[model samples]
Target: MTLEGALIRSEGLSIRHGGREVLRDVSFAIEAGEIVTVVGPNGSGKSTLLKALIGALPPAAGRVTRRAGLRLGYVPQGLRLDPSMPMTVGRFLNLPKRVAEEGRTRALAEAGAQGLEDRPLTALSGGQFQRVLLARALLDRPELLILDEPTTGLDQPGQAAFYQRLEDVRNSLGCAVLMVSHELHVVMSASDRVLCVNGHICCEGRPEVVAQAEEYRALFGTGTGGALALYRHEHSHRHDETCELDHTHGEDT
Candidate 1:
């Protein structure tokens, strides 16, 4: 909330696409070494916010500021590699920038995809491919890791496993994480803070608080209320990692 040493901050940000405003007056700050999840229904500008944060999209108004000399790594919601391209995992990791073999192997191992270097990119299953993408992001040892729905196609168990692996990565690297996810059940349990968005931030707080907020319930309905209840019961026993002080701040409109 203080914005001191924030890794990235958006101040009254707005975005436009195709002559229509997608987001308006949205603002938040991601601090160092915290996990923040953005949740919204489809077309709520969740992904748009991510692109703007990463500088892939220009803001129509307001500003996105990053700490000086920030190192950022991004894992997109989906990547379409041409099936015709004959690329191996090792080669893929070295794209645009070449990494030493040792670094590549270590990153892959950390992403839970060890020994996948020589395998063709086409040969990997959906889960393995996601892990490889995570490996690529880790190559730079980023100070801020951004993921846009990195667990799209995985099943429930697989999604949990992937998030667990992500938690491990964040712990070991000591990097802040900003992710956009639709999985309320998983994100509520995993995140340090959760922001609910509907073209603008509706509510934000520690997951439990947001889950109970009228804004969140109005958007997601009582169906997910059960998930939040389940999360409260299981979360204490699950994530043993310590979180930084809760820094959730936003107007609950």
Candidate 2:
């Protein structure tokens, strides 16, 4: 099942919660084999867009088109672990089903949760639980993966490794990924396209180009005078080069 054309499209989409318009007229498309990341600060409607995409929330207005027969694997913003649910990691992987021995092992290993197979889901720390959920996402071998804030509550190394694992899964499954993330530096290189959302798409483009936009500055707080610093350095370098050349010629004359 190839999704070469647009697999997901939103046109004039809007959502209102508690009489507050969280998203308005947001339009975007995600294609097959492409990784499109939604980036913005908290309360910026990033998660709202994800919920709308996954059919958890209906758009108050507009259209969302998902390609027919496309399977979606979603990891929501947080995994609510229940201490009372005495399910082991392995059981969680095969949740609501009888586990096939081989399938259970493969999923755990792929998620880097092999050693955690017998541990209860509630016993796992934040990072462990994140990996467990990721393992579950892989079970169906979805055509598209939607991850909302995948790295939340993870340490730096775990976050980096999680992305690396995602890259591996994307390659292995040959599925597209749509992720909501604030860790720009991590996803910038991995993403095929970037969607910057703040109420609506402030901008969407290649990572490097989007990184330079004013909207990106407002979104990432990274372009905060960095472009000016770069320009200043370039200006200083040219000035120094001209001075050196002039001084050399004067000495020769």
Candidate 3:
């Protein structure tokens, strides 16, 4: 795919932690208004790649380029909030950066947490907390919204609902989304493109094509039969772009 005017581009990018290389010679580009999900087994450098793309980690080799003054909003894999410290959702959103009341309310509403403004952080359920995190990310009207496993603890129904909200957020904001997730079914169902990464790019393409690739099958098996069932149900309602799929069988990094 032509990645002209890419929001972020990496060429032959390599990353290292301590003495071991986490990712090597990886190249890809995230264009504006695209939803890209990175999937891999644990310790496959999925999180490392996200950090590199967002400039939280410097590349040990090659380069990562971002659009000038790119606005970024990141939702981490998990956030620990002290139960003893009293903090409300409203108070948390204003921390360090105070946005207008109208903007705050609109952001919360868009994230499907409209009435949660006054709720204490500790009072929210797992799914509600994730929505709050998303609300916080949307406050800045970011150009690139990066989420690392945003739906970790939710049950199947919750995961599906959250991903739907995520798709809604992307549509309403028109921001490119780069998220790391292990929920194959949800990722495949919602992504515009999926990248199967295990230390390096394994295979990347549309959800349907990637699901059938041998490389992807090798990493996550066909247990996704249920996921595929869900995909067929959802697929009938949407128009998917027709693009040639790209598959890579690189040696593990």
Residue-level lDDT of model 3, residues 108-151, one tens digit each, is 99899999999999999999999999999999999999999988
Q: Best candidate, TM-score-wise?
A: 1
The TM-scores, one per candidate, come to: 0.82, 0.77, 0.80
Of 1 and 3, the candidate ahead on TM-score is 1
> Which structure among the candidates has the greatest lDDT?
1
Candidate 2 residue runs with Cα over 4 Å from true position: 1-4, 97-99, 184-188, 209-253
Candidate 2: tens digits of C-alpha lDDT, residues 1-253: 2334888888899998889999999988888878888766567799999999988888999989999988787888887866666788877777777667787777677877778888988888888888888878878878889999988987655666677788878888888899888553335346777775667776565555354656445543552222111000011122334334433443343
TM-score of 1: 0.82
lDDT of 1 by residue, 171-232 (tens): 89999999888654337345788876667776566655465666556544654433331112
Number of residue pairs clashing in candidate 2, backbone atoms closer than 3 angstroms, sequence gap of 3 or more or interchain: 0
Superposed Cα deviation of residue 20, candidate 2 (Å)? 0.9
Residue 249 of model 1: what lDDT?
15
Q: What is the lDDT of residue 160 in candidate 3?
A: 58
Q: Rank the candidates by TM-score, best first.
A: 1, 3, 2
Superior candidate under lDDT, 2 versus 3: 3
The lDDT of model 3 is 0.77
